[model samples]
Target chain A: MNRFKSFVIKEFYHIFRDRRSLIVLFGIPIAQVLLFGFVITNDIRNAKIAVLDYSKDDISREITNKIVSSQYFSLAETLNNDKDIEGIFKKGRVKMVLVFENNFAHDLENTGKANIQIIADATDPNLANLLVSYLSAIIMNYTLDMNRLAVVPMQINMESRMFYNPELKSVYMFVPGVMAMILMLISAFMTSITITREKESGTMEILLVSPLRPSQIIIGKVVPYVLLSFSSAVMIILLGIFVFGMPVEGNFILLLAESLLFIILALSLGILISTIANSQQTAMLMSMVALMLPTILLSGFVFPIENMPFILQLLAHIMPPKYFIIIVKNIMLKGTGFSYVWKETLVLIFMTFFFIMLSIKKFKVRLE
Target chain B: MENQVVITSKNMIKKFGDFVANDHLNFEVYKGEIFGFLGANGAGKTTAMKILCGLLTPTSGEIFVGGFNVYTETEKIKRSIGYMSQKFSLYEDLTVFENIRFYSGIYGLSDADIKMKSNNLMDKLGLSAQRNSLISSLPLGWKQKLAFSIAIIHDPQIVFLDEPTGGVDPITRRQFWDLIYDAAHNGITVFVTTHYMDEAEYCDRISIMVDGRIEALDTPFNLMKTYNSENMDGVFLKLARA
Candidate 1:
């Protein structure tokens, strides 16, 4: 026990002495979280749009009012001629342009048909698609209300109800992702680099020559990192709850327990990486390429795994953070307990065992 | 073979696939003697030392250290012996006192025993004043000495020194030999490997290896007379050339 204490103390000294490691462990998580939450979001608001009404009629005017009042778009200009559309779009100030046919009210009253053209800048396809959807929904709702007044009805309506996040707040989604990423960085990447540093410096040979068993040595190296990652996890959760208004609807203990489990899985990954890397720089590079890329790309932290190709979706299922994100989102948004999360919990357990078994095999081979 | 042998290897072979490192060589070191093992850059002195230290297992044949077989009783042999490599493996971020305490703790020394012995060891090596200083700040010679001292801090029966004096001033080399002599005087058998012929003369008995086999083993004077050489260097060159 005294030996283990001394070993842990040495690990702490290594961590505190390296300033670069300090920043990578603590600075990266909060920066990424704030950037993803505030800077990169899908739910755009207050986009400027231009309108051209060739018809001087009540139907066209009513449709214009409905578009402006929906709050999804704003009228930046009212173009008098068709030539204005090119210049407005080229200036980049207007994201969308609307045109109404010459006899809109006459056509609607006599033939029950009116034509409107909504043209969006297709350079950013995602934004264009969202603008098209929001506008169509608003127009359809207005037409349905008009049909109710006219006695004959020919209108279609579509209502979107976002389930987990009704307000579509980006913070609700990014907070859990940021927490998983930061915990993996601190636990796996940092711990692996530290252990490989010792190996490169020859201090690991000294420790191995001593009477301490290999298991004791490994545990001693990893325990301090587990504690550090746990604290970082808590800090992110608190920031998400208090500062960003992300809900914490589930039991705090369950959230913490899942976080701890994932932290251990990441720590074992660090150990596994140390066995493969001969130098600290090599270990850091490996962690970034192997752990960070997979965690970010394949773990559904940014991109949706369901939309990926089949092979990539299979690869995503093996990523540890995928399961971790599911658990975090479930507890925070769904207020779920173990009964609801047992499948994900079991998957995490299997991944942890896989990493531990591979690391132990590598360690034994190194000992030989 | 002598009955009181501390190290005994009989046709011991170590091979990595087809490359034979220690090839069916036989040698012995008796108790309470400074035995020197010398060879050129790739003559397999390190391979033999690693096998004896329980860090590596030989490919074939029998090897024993402290009367325990390398194949079956490696952990027991590791417990009964100590090893120090030329790398001077000490944690640079740790204080001198902390390094010593850490080694002692892992070696299963009690806290009171560690404190007492660490103080006495540091005082004897004239490093008592810098006990709290980080190992990185100390000179290379001091680090080497501290590493040698810590290697045998457990008071093992035999200590293996694999080129312990690789790079240092002549003064530090002489001081390191003095520590080895001190260990010999206390009945701790010293099995050391070195390239310096002057250091070879200080050993009670010396062995020169050539192509993974010992070509000469005796007192320096006897080997010189047998080879008709003026110094140990001439003898080593002649044997290496043959």
Candidate 2:
């Protein structure tokens, strides 16, 4: 027990003594969270828009004020003629434009129908899609509010509704993905590098020749990484909850327990990688190419797996992050319990056990 | 030297496929003597040492280290022997005291024993002022000597040195031998491998390996006379060329 404790202390000294590793271990998580929250977001505020009211009447003007006052859209220019609609779009000043058709109040009152035109710049397709839908939702809300006061309601079958997240904030999607990514990269990177460093520097020879068993050396090296990655995982969760207003609707303890399972999964993968790699550079390269890229691209973190090609979708199914993201999203957003996440938990547990077994086998092969 | 065997091997054959690394080798090392193991590169020196250290399993052999069988009692053998490889084994990022304390602790030394031994070691090496300095900051010779000290920190019965003085001045190498002599004087067996033929003369007995076999083994003076050579280097050349 004292030998194990001494080994662990030695590992901590290696971790805290290096400035580059300290920065990577603690600094990257918070920076990634804040960057995803504020910079690369889908939520828009005060987007510039142009208006053209051919009707020039009270009802059209009232609807225009409602759109601008919602804070999601701001009026850039009010054109007199339709000629400037295409001209303003070419100038790239506004993301969207709204056109109210002629005799809007007369048509709505008599026939309960009125036409409105929405033009958007689709040069950047995702942003354009978001802009047009946000404008349509604002107009629909105004019409619904107007219907409550009037005796008649408009016959509109198509309605817009977003559940679990009414505002459809992009931060909610990124938080879970970021947690999986940060935990996987940090835990795996730390373990793989630490183990391979001994081999690279010739320390493994001395360690192997000592009375300490190989299992004791491995477990002692890994215990410190577990604590480091878990604390950083906690830091990310707290940042998501308090800073970005993310929801933790599920049982908090279950959420943490699930996170622990994922961390152990990553740690075991690192050990397996170290067993295969002979140098620290090889270990780091393998972790980046094998773990990081898949976590970011194929795991549905930044890209939706459903929209991917058939082959890539099949590839994404093998990635651990895909299931971890699902587990996190279900618990945090859907307010689910163990019954909903048991399958994912089992998958993570199985992967951890599989990697650990492979590592032991590889280590034994080295002895021969 | 006492006529007590600390290490012995009988018909040790370690083969890697068609190539043989240690072929039918046999030798014995007695207690309280500096025994030298010499060979050219790839002459099977490292392979034999690893098998004796209980790190590598032999293909077929009867080997005993500190009276423990290499196959059935590897753990006991590990506890009774210490090793220093050619490459620097101490953690460069750690301090001198920290490295010593860590190695001693892992060998199951008590805290009080570690404390006293570490201080005495630093004082004897005249490095007491640099006790807390990182190994990376120390000179290469100091690091090499420190590595040798930590290898036998637990006062094991036998200490193995695999070319422990590779890249250092001759004066420092001589000082390293002084330390080895001190250990042997304190009744510890020293099993050392080196390519420096001049250093081989200091050993009480030395073995020369060519290919995968021990071509010659004797006292340095006897081997010099048998080969009709003036020095240990000439004796090595005569056997290697044959």
Candidate 3:
């Protein structure tokens, strides 16, 4: 134990002595959380749109008023003719245009049907789709209100409720993902680089020949990183709660415990990487290519895994962070218990065991 | 000295697949003597040293280090020996005082012992003024000397130096040999490997390895007479040419 203590202190000295790495360690978590929370969001607020009202009627005017009154959109320009629709979108001032056909109210009154054309600039298809949906929702609500007063016999009323995230806040989605990515980056990438650094400097040989066991050496090297990654995880959670109003709906202790499990998993992966790489540069490259890219792209951090190709969906299932993100989201957003997340937690545990075993095998081979 | 064999190996062989790294090696190192193992690049000097240090297992041979079997008692062997590599292994980020303290602590030395011993070592090395300085700030010669001191900080029974004076100047190398003599005089066995034939002359006994085999082992004077050469380098050249 005394030897392990000294070894850990020496490892800490290496970390604290390097100022650039120190900055990157603490800076990345905060920056990622804040950037993902405030800047990159899917929630549309005050989206710019145009209205082309050919029907000079009270109903058309009321519908236009309703669309702009909601926080989802703001009227940017009024198009006088059909020719102005393309011009407004070409200027990039508006993402969508709502054109009501002439005699719209007359058609609704007599034939009970009216045509409203939604012309959207599909340059950014996601934003255009969202704007059209918001407009449709408002129009649907207006028609339902009209039907309620008119005593319509046949009406289909659809009620929807979004369970976990009621307001559809993007921060609720990004906070857990950012936590997974930051923890993986710090634990796997940093630890692999540190271990490979010792190998490069020839210190690892000295340590290996020392009285300390191989397990002790590995544990001592990674304990400091475990503490650091855990602290970063807590900081991200606190930022989500205070800044973005995201709730930790489940047991806080369970969430932290699961974060620790994932951190250990990532550290074991780092050990495996270090065993394969002979230099710090190789370890760094391997970690970025194998761990970071997969965590960012295939783990559903930015894009939905279900929307990927069939082969990519199969590939995503093998990523450890995919399960970790799900576990975190379940605990933080849905307030789910261990029962709800047992499979994901089990997968993480199995992966940790597998990586540790592989690392030990490779380390022994290296010694030989 | 007495016939106290500190290291004994009989027909020790280490093979990487079909290539024999240390083929049929046989030697015995007595206690309190400076024994040198000399070889050219890829002559299997490092492979033999690693086996002696308990870092690798011999393919099929009997080897003992510090009275512990190299195959079954590797952990015990590790605790009883000190090893320094050719690459000057020391934590450059750590201060001179901290490096000593760290190595001593891992060797199971107490805090009080480490404090006193480190002070004594720094004072002896004339590094007391730079005790707080990082190892990287010191000159190459000073760093090599400090690394040697730290390797033996535990007072192990045997110290293995694998080209400990590789990159330093001749003056520092001479001074390093002086340090080696001092340690040997204190009754610690020194096992060193080097390619510098001149340095081999300073050893009590030298073994020259060629093609994964020890071609010659004798005192410098005996080797000179047998090879009909004036110096250790000339003897090495003749053996390598043969």
lDDT of 3 by residue, B1-242 (tens): 65899999999999999999999999999999999999899999999999998889999899999999999999999999998988889899999999998999899999999999999999999999999999989999999999999988899899999999988899999999999999988888999998787899999999999999999999999999999999999999998889
Better model by TM-score: candidate 1 vs candidate 2: 2
Query: Best-fitting candidate, measured by lDDT?
Result: 3
Candidate 1 at residue A250, lDDT? 88
Categorize the docking of model 3.
high
Can you rank all candidates by lDDT, best first? 3, 2, 1
DockQ winner: 3
Residue lDDT tens for model 1, A78-196:
99899999999999989999999899999999998889999999899988998998888788888888887888744455567888788778788788888888888899998898889
1 versus 3: better lDDT goes to: 3
For candidate 1, the lDDT comes to 0.87
Local accuracy by lDDT, each model: 0.87, 0.92, 0.93
Span of ten consecutive residues with least summed lDDT in model 3 chain A: A19-28
In the range A1-368, model 2's lDDT, one tens digit per residue, is: 87887799999999999998888789999999999999989888999999989998889999899889989889999988889988999998898888989998899888888999999888989988988888888778887887877777446646757888988899999999999999988889889999999999999999999999999999998999899998998999999999999999999899889899999999999999999999999999999999999999998989999999999999999899999999999999999999999999898888899999999999989877
Provide the global lDDT of candidate 3 against the true structure: 0.93
Model 3 C-alpha lDDT per residue in residues A1-368, reported as the tens digit of each score: 88888999998899999996787689989999999999999999998889998997989999999989898989998888999887887889989899999999999988889989999999998888887887898899999988888877877898778899988899998998999899999999999999999999999999988989999999999999999899889999999999999999999999999999999999999999999999999998999999999999999989999999999999999999999999999999899999999999999999999999999999999999
Judge the docking of candidate 1 as incorrect, acceptable, medium or high.
Answer: medium
Candidate 2 Cα outliers beyond 4 Å, as residue runs: A147-160
Q: How many backbone clashes does candidate 1 have?
A: 0
